[model samples]
Target chain A: MPDKSLRMRRAGGDGLVTRPVMLAIAGDSAAGKTTMTRGLVEALGPDRCVSLCTDDYHRYDREERKELPFTALHPDCNHLDIMEQHLQLLATGNPVLKPVYDHATGELVRPELVEPAEFVIVEGLFPLWSKLSRACFDVTVFLDPPEEIRRGWKVARDTSKRGYTQEKVLAELERREEESAAYIRPQRQNADLVVRFAPIEGRDDPAGTSLSASLMMRPTIDHPDLTDVLQSGLSRAMHLKLERDPDGRPVETLHVHGYVPREESLGVEKAIWSALGAPDTETPECLGRLGDARSEPLAIAQLLLLYHLTDAAR
Target chain B: MPDKSLRMRRAGGDGLVTRPVMLAIAGDSAAGKTTMTRGLVEALGPDRCVSLCTDDYHRYDREERKELPFTALHPDCNHLDIMEQHLQLLATGNPVLKPVYDHATGELVRPELVEPAEFVIVEGLFPLWSKLSRACFDVTVFLDPPEEIRRGWKVARDTSKRGYTQEKVLAELERREEESAAYIRPQRQNADLVVRFAPIEGRDDPAGTSLSASLMMRPTIDHPDLTDVLQSGLSRAMHLKLERDPDGRPVETLHVHGYVPREESLGVEKAIWSALGAPDTETPECLGRLGDARSEPLAIAQLLLLYHLTDAAR
Candidate 1:
């Protein structure tokens, strides 16, 4: 099949030009990608931002994957060609008939029509795997929580939402660890921002103390200036440090403190909201929700991505 | 009276030398100096940090100052010489019998013993006015809130706490403004950091949007690197902007946004907390309280000063 990007090319003299800012949030399963995407959609308003999960393009049902030698992290397990094509369509502000994989039932569902909005966020495992797919995005992010934290999240999610036993979830995670390492984790190198939310180091926090965040700001794109924010010294909960990434590249890491008072955290949020020039006077309530618990770092990461989207609009 | 610092100098002592990190928070009445100092004391722990209000050095009671030609902002209206001696003593880890000025009754009460801790935070109207006084501090901050905001705060504080009418408070502010401009405001020029907490520029927030803050990070002192915090793009609510101060000096200003989600502000606070090495998991609970409401910018300013205090210790 001809790549859909070719079909999406605007013909000369046609004068039908439409372009929406496209952002790709790529990560492994239960990496909080969808939750992060939801906050952006809410912050930008549903009417202006549209989101799609590329996991919907799974080649087989969940039970079918059991018979295969490889897990869903493998490219062969997903329809990367179609996902790339749809991403191309969305990038140019076009519509597509998209397939859906229902997570609860682990079954393929009927296709549905999807219209692109002013901002399009494509989030899933393989959105950044191919050069053609990567080209469709104006900005890209990779969620890279520690493996242990990710495992806890996945086990909880799979057990509660997908009806899998804790043992089954752990077994599956062990089974897919190699594929995830080979494929999904590599996407972090291509991301403009790599976000990791985890427990703060060297502190014995109370039971409800929020988890801290470490954001690796790669120099792949123009980022907002935060010297004023850091220098404002408004709250001790957040800070920035320079460090070397695993690939020996110089990267700036921003760590957000958790377990501070609620109002203090909001102070940082409003500053970010103002920076984005977003119309809202408050942060989206949909952010940071993991079941009943909330994550400050997750909300902040989403807000930064929202900044990129709204900034692109300007 | 024998100068405590002169006695502390020890012309020919063999050893027994120790020094305490001193921080000066100088500002006019109701500029939130005591509130700011409280947070730092809490963050560093009371055992390690001792705070004193320089207003305690008043040469005359409030009624006596009322009959005098000059207001409290005048150098002569305070025991500047004694304050200098005390500061010098505190700077080198010595104790002093500091006089107490009772704000409620407008009386010069009995003196109280003050022991020097690892960190000494001296806050009031004239802590940074003199060469000798300025030399006693390792770090200095000037709170320069807008006159309008200061007026409102003063009026509210005087009427409720000190038994003064709103009209009387306003008249007092006007009477003190000239002395404040000459004595208190000029101290801002010498400060390593100048903090201004007020409403965000050009935003009509609701009745309860926490006030925004601007901190001028002067290069006079070595400041923590905040490049990563700004680049992280986590909270658009906080940002660092380069701008010129009133004296035409180039300064980096950090602005913390208010009214954002609590989590967002915490993200910024956590980053700073992490930068400070996260010895304690929770932020100082006493921070961000401006009267009943909390100011994130105030907390951040305190935290930054805390960084300088601890950094000096190292």
Candidate 2:
């Protein structure tokens, strides 16, 4: 009801909700922020779901950032105030002149105008790091993949795409680890859903098995009913359990096995499609793709975020 | 490769295998067999998936069956040998003239011709009752919902659909309990997967919460990797544990909690879909519905069977 009330305040006076519902997906670099948002944008349709990166708020370009004492992960290295202002504008369904940060060139390009669509997904390191930034979105998510895995992903991505050597990437990761611990990780506490994709702790699965995923579902928002999909008694690839978070709060944790066959993951996908009111006639084909490869965990996580984005609009 | 060999044997020597993969869904009356199979048919497409009820093998009409000393569940009351032969015929992609027992009119109608499609799902009390029948399927599933829930579902269905009063249904249930225990229940042991749908043992969820389900993944056949789903930290609605069955064999039991939101179930479903090779463009819309009411457990059970049916074809 309160959520509806908030929606009312943000709507146009003509009794139609022209305001775009906002979602914030925040995480550290190489923490799967972009990968997560990519599927969401595809699933929701790029025309309807406007996506942006909060890293664009960087006051200093990559070259300039090197002179700073703090790493990019630190609050001092970024323009939190400007990011928050842009979020507020987007939340009210207003357009903003958003800056761009090119990862490949490490350059801050000229600002470009962006109009709010039916839904807006903002992904970056500090989207939920401040109260003002957090309040601008109806739903928030944080990626918390294991540090080692993140490091590996970061190294591989940077060396291949960003023109960095593996050694440079690893060293940069080590340098940024401290700031990440202080600034990026804490944002997870504010998220409605904390997603972690990692390998299972004990199993020595034969080669070609994908990593498993664990999501901490905090009661910050109403989620889709997953009991049916998990309990369908037909799949062994997924499960859910009520557990306690680090803050001692009771939360539900959903674990999705990646090594399972693709059909098992599709079961959960259909459940989501129905929960999302069967948004399209079919599940978005663009989902589950990471570069040329496919990742089911990423797709499911994006679908959950998509559910919230659309559910809030309704 | 061996499975392919069997396929070759079934084909008409063209080297292009055409044998339909078989799946057996065996359960007692009102065990959610039809409800479960309905989704598979829809998900796989009616053109590709053929479904048959082995109960149609009843030697006598329902009215005449009432006069017999043995219940319909008893081996003597049905043409189980004929059913076994038919199963073998279907398994090898052959056609069969199958008997039809019309539940609506309580009569033995004319036999119908059945040609196996890409997939065949056989549901009834005795489909897996005999070893010969069990060997006819590439995969087998047993529905073992709680007696109380089954009784409630049966009463609701028989009174509303069949020409039976609640009292008569109850009496019939009591009369058939012995036969169900002796003849129907034992068939569960022969199944590769045992699905039990029921409420959580302790909690009293308010109305509208669906029933939970527990699936016993027996090691009779290799299952897709589900560890990724069980280990994914996102959901609390589902869980997996290695436990001992009544026969003392170690099995993996997956429990899906019904109280979690639909989102949690979607996570698990996507994991399964990924495991199943992301069959189709979407999750089957026909799954999880039972007489206008949707049951997540039923949908999931159906999805799992669909996985087997499709997986065998691959």
Candidate 3:
């Protein structure tokens, strides 16, 4: 909420964070992480944020992997220790030569230089699996959509975008389910926040195809003022749906309908702010944050969390 | 032979023996293939002889080979198809980017350009083993030295030239022996000539260690005149040590002892050449077929034989 360095200076001691703030976006293949990430990144602009993918850590290319006993999804199939070391280097405000994975030929080609920025988002399925690498991240979010939605998304995305046929995508999804459960799904329970973007079932308005999203923020961590998040008006047509998280844990859900009116979404955003103790200043103290115009509320929420993560470390 | 080319030209035919020749030099590791190749090349000059090594075909470095099931000596551990293709290309007067094997580090550092010349000396352990490749060589020689001599040479070369310890050198030699036996030694039996250089086993010469050499020539097919070989003073010192080959094939063996005097070695070379018929030009009606020093006996025997082999098919 304040100049982090100045905040510490005013607090009368030099105790401050030194490492750059990092976030890990862990999700299954075709689980809406990239779509959500692209939208949020576009809204935030590029100067203050940078992104890296975990696929570059794979030791062998697709063709090479066919000869190996383990599939690419297994941790041993990647140079995880090397990846971990690179993440630590980036967290300390440096850079690394990231290996290139050519999706067209499914080969590992030349490496490219990846420079670190103030906010780093490392996105991949196994990003949170290695504890040593996880130590570099300040904010960790896991995307968990229902299996039916995930499968549908995977089929559509793989067929349309990855040069796969519908049958092949579906068959691959079925085959991967066991490994997905064994390795990927368990990571959701450990995230600082869990995000899900899907239509709330059983809701059939005359308008049809209602969609909703919820950000489950854990307590005992620094919370952000929602004044900036409300500016993008993402929750305007949505409802701040809350209920006991099945395991007796506290959880809040935002449920939006596809055909909901725009003004209603704005109203939902306002409710979210009122719920988070939106900053009381007349104009708002968040700049460089959520910005003035071009963005969405969900994006602003993501940035606000990143600010807290890096600022708290300082 | 008379000028058959002149008679053929008059009869509307060609008798210049316009075929590519194959020359193979097989030897154990560090047994002087590279050294002898350097000497032959210098003497013949670049225009007449081109030397290439099979070491360039290795698929992995030494460190990587330790993890592999087979040793580098195995054909599967090399890009043999590419090598055979390159060899065929070179035999047809084409150039190839022959890969370089850094013997010191046991790595393929880079590919070197090797253009076809008049004589192509293919030197390596398994050069003669490939049936398809043998059709390309015109002459083949195997370098044979005693086991103790080879070990001493390897120890000295690996320590001083390759930067290896005597212990490591010995261990590597032992590790490669099985693969060598299964892959390299059989090629020796296919050689046209076996040249062995070693000290006389029991003789003690007071002056110096005058090691003898034996050049076992099986020129059952067309070969350059031995008269030229005798004229050069190598024939007299070569005692005809006849023996049946291991396969029970009858053959003539020419032996030169370590204790032989220099003058006698020269005398022996002359006696063999005189016996072969180089001085047959003494008649009044017969002008010598070779009128220039360029066609000298030693040059014709060594370099021309190389030329015949490499140009046999082409």
Candidate 4:
């Protein structure tokens, strides 16, 4: 409990060779992190990867906290130290007993045992907030979207599945904004990639029909091998380029078109796998490279990084 | 919490006519209380009946308690007084913010606001253990399925739903016997009715596919006017008889056969409704009787008794 951030950093830096890969999917409420994570988990299978949400560590059961001054989204309202410990444990391949929170009811549910896998994706707001929690991850992604887009997504999801009335959804969103700004927004600066999907820029972008994205990749890490990935799968409209953010850090940006051929994505995967020098074995497909939009490419790129780090461990 | 039982008895003896009625279904672990209660709830409709699990108030999350001497089922391992407060709140029209428990992972999940309904059913091991809780119940039931039947039900349920191995279930069952006896079994004497379902007395009477049920009813609560019910349609095999335990307390027993047709149940319902003399309007079909092989007559008897108790209070 002595400042979890300090412990996480200490645990992370001590005897670290090629640091074990850590990734975070930071997003506002329901911006598709769960959907994307589901696909990733399906592709990688749960054995090689485990995903956890930072919301589990809320400090109070919903009712008791209602009397508190601050809402649950605030830092003081969570067991940040305990969450950091579990993250560290997971990153180190040890099992951690994590707390449970019921989203629909706004209460702390039960604790669940989470065994570590090769990759752990920590998803939620403020996941990248504390230096300790951030120290535990080697790669972090932030999801950003326009207000109206996020709100629309929230409305449809909550009403149909969660029994929420329109008024409750809007009220909750309004109440959470202050905490989101103070605690969740700052975490984006620490992320390796920031993915944003919104109506396309600079045109007659129909309300919700178009999509565009921006990715911010930290320069400290080695880039993925993307030679064959670039040659196939991606339509001519899909391309990658480098740009410097306002902070002056270089970013690798991938632009994906609204409509891309499926085979091209498959071909891109094959190319990236071949670049990994593993000789295009079917074993990787079974290992879970089957669904990445650029699954083959991302699989090879991700696996190459993993192989390098694990090999360096020995 | 000024002794919840004291509060309830005050509501009764002091002539508080407006308070919502509270009913409890008490039993040992794996008893048929959940199934029976589910039937009642579904039949009554969730709006009319609100049910809370005292089991949800465990003091420790599942993993932490694994190393502790007391299991989750032990009284000392839960926050009982808090549970009493919630029950008292629920017994009124007020809402109780109750704790959430995750059944799959055996952890405390979150809390939810449980609004009081017309009839509240508190179902769990210690529902009737404390005198404070006993005072709140307008009617109490103890489901005492034979040990063998309970064990069979438990093993099947735990293995299928809880991720427990057969050996683990058996071992846990063995471990719980002492605590169950000490903390749970004594509640039977305090209950208004004890419903037992087991293999009917004859092993060779193969067509005796019905489970025998004994309703140990305490007949002193002045019975309701069942004239309307008796006149409406209660003559179908639904007959009442008086029974006595070895200890000599008068017990009103009602027996319904497994093969009793549905129409006969409607008749029993109409008679009970007529007896209440509350309203002459049609009683909805959904309000039909909850049968436990022989509970039709016993329920009619129980309702008549409840009606008179309310009238006496007024």
Best by DockQ: 4
Off by over 4 Å in 3: A1-18, A204-207, A225-248, A256-260, A267-314, B1-314
Range of the 10 consecutive residues with the lowest summed lDDT in candidate 1 chain A? A1-10
TM-score list, all predictions: 0.47, 0.47, 0.43, 0.46
With candidate 2 superimposed using the best TM-score fit, by how many Å does residue A169's alpha carbon deviate from the native? 95
TM-score of 4: 0.46
Residue runs of model 2 more than 4 Å from their true location after superposition: A1-314, B1-17, B203-207
Return model 4's CA RMSD, one decimal: 19.1
* Candidate number that wins on lDDT, 2 or 4: 2
Worst 10 residues of 4 chain B by lDDT: B1-10
**On a 0 to 100 scale, what is the lDDT of residue A209 in model 4?**
34
lDDT of 3 at B43: 56
Error (Å) of candidate 1 at residue A235 is 85
Per-residue accuracy of model 1 over B49-135 as CA lDDT, tens digit each: 889999887877887887899988889887776676567656656565566788899887545557888888899998888766777
RMSD of each: 32.5, 31.3, 25.1, 19.1
List model 2 lDDT by residue over B38-119, tens digit each.
7788788889989999978786778788789988889998877567756755665556556677787777654455788988
lDDT for position B16 in model 4? 29
What are the per-model numbers of colliding residue pairs? 48, 66, 40, 19
lDDT of 1 at B145: 87
